[model samples]
Target: MNRLSRVSIAAFALAAGAALTGCVVAPVGPYYGEPVVTAPPPPQVEAVPVAPYPGWLWIGGYWTWQANRHVWVGGHWAAPRPGWRYVPHRWDPGPRGWREAPGRWERR
Candidate 1:
């Protein structure tokens, strides 16, 4: 291969390796945020798609607070926790407002 062709091939290999490192093999815990005053609207209906891998489950989406407003985050399939169950993210009503509890995997 010419010098230019060799350089292009090397760059392509590096990009492919970087992309493969980001595979989601398991569910990750969510980040917490400040509470919002406005209550979230009803959850939107979503059609669960096929799992990327076997044993994955559809984790339904929930309302999230951003910029003091409720936003709809779409749902997706997640790799199941072998010895644990997922606690869904939710916004609980409080005296100050709605407090957001991040989703987490808990031992069964």
Candidate 2:
């Protein structure tokens, strides 16, 4: 077989193996929803307390938009999810205005 044919066969084999494995890779990005009229206040400096239980993770405090204003949510300890990671709530300044994203657990 020619070099081009060998390369094409190798690529096909790799693709087939990946398909059989059912593995998929995709780019994850923040979801931009409606813009808030005002920006959120700066995050508070939190002194994370010790975990009440072993293997627990600290979820930091963040500013949340509520009732047309910013509200401070205290930090707390949460039991770790087996195959997921915690996403802290945050606000991002977009072209239109500040956008708020709520905390969530996403697959690792």
Among the numbered candidates, top TM-score falls to 1
Q: Model 2, residue 3: displacement in angstroms?
A: 94
Residues 11-82, candidate 2: write the lDDT tens digits: 999999988897778676434466876888778999888789999999998877665667899999999999
Sum up the clashes in candidate 1.
0
Clashing residue pairs in candidate 1 (N, C-alpha, C atoms within 3 angstroms): none
Q: In model 2, which regions exceed 4 Å deviation?
A: 1-32
> Per-residue error at 27 for model 2, in Å?
36
Worst 10 residues of 2 by lDDT: 25-34
